[model samples]
Target: MASRRTISSEKGFIEKGDATAFSPAALEKSNIAPAVPPGVIFKLLAFTFAMVVFPIGSYFATVNTIFRGKMSNSTFAGATAAFIANVVLIGYVIVAMKEDQSERLEAEEEAKKSK
Candidate 1:
């Protein structure tokens, strides 16, 4: 994956792309605001919830199948759990990135004032 570069100043965050540059406030507004539309965030949250719940449901289903001599092994349950875990992990990463951006902006503001 290509790494991103951002410069946060007193006013706001700067957005930079590969070989691209943006002034302080220009970057902050674009980067800090939610990328997805308002409704989309809820939709994404709902989808992620489904991802976790479906795997849990599958685990029980797999168990039932095993009891009835249907599923020959535990692979299905394990795979489902792994998929759900990955999605949730990605969700956490997104949150962490957002928080980090906020913190960086705050620090930059303080530095500007001190100077």
Candidate 2:
């Protein structure tokens, strides 16, 4: 097995005894932020839960054909509910994106007016 890599930064992007040091000018020009917003993280987690739940629920819902020849109503209902909830969550993501676009456009318009 390979040894674990250790990272140490002193002055922005600079590592002790490492030649791949970034200059202040380079650091100033770079921009980075959280890979995903906290809200998005939660949304993703919820979607993932739905993804896992839906299949199991579906399998249970169709257990009559896949397994024992008896259908479970509760499993079918649960699967339907999860499907609907995920649909709503997906819609919310789309709406949020549209709202963000609107807000960005408004900011640009205001900037132009000021100029």
Q: How high is the CA lDDT of each candidate model?
A: 0.67, 0.68
Estimate the TM-score for candidate 2. 0.40
**Whole-model lDDT, model 1:** 0.67
Pairs in steric clash, model 2: none
lDDT of 1 by residue, 71-96 (tens): 65566567756777777677767876
TM-scores, all models, native as reference: 0.37, 0.40
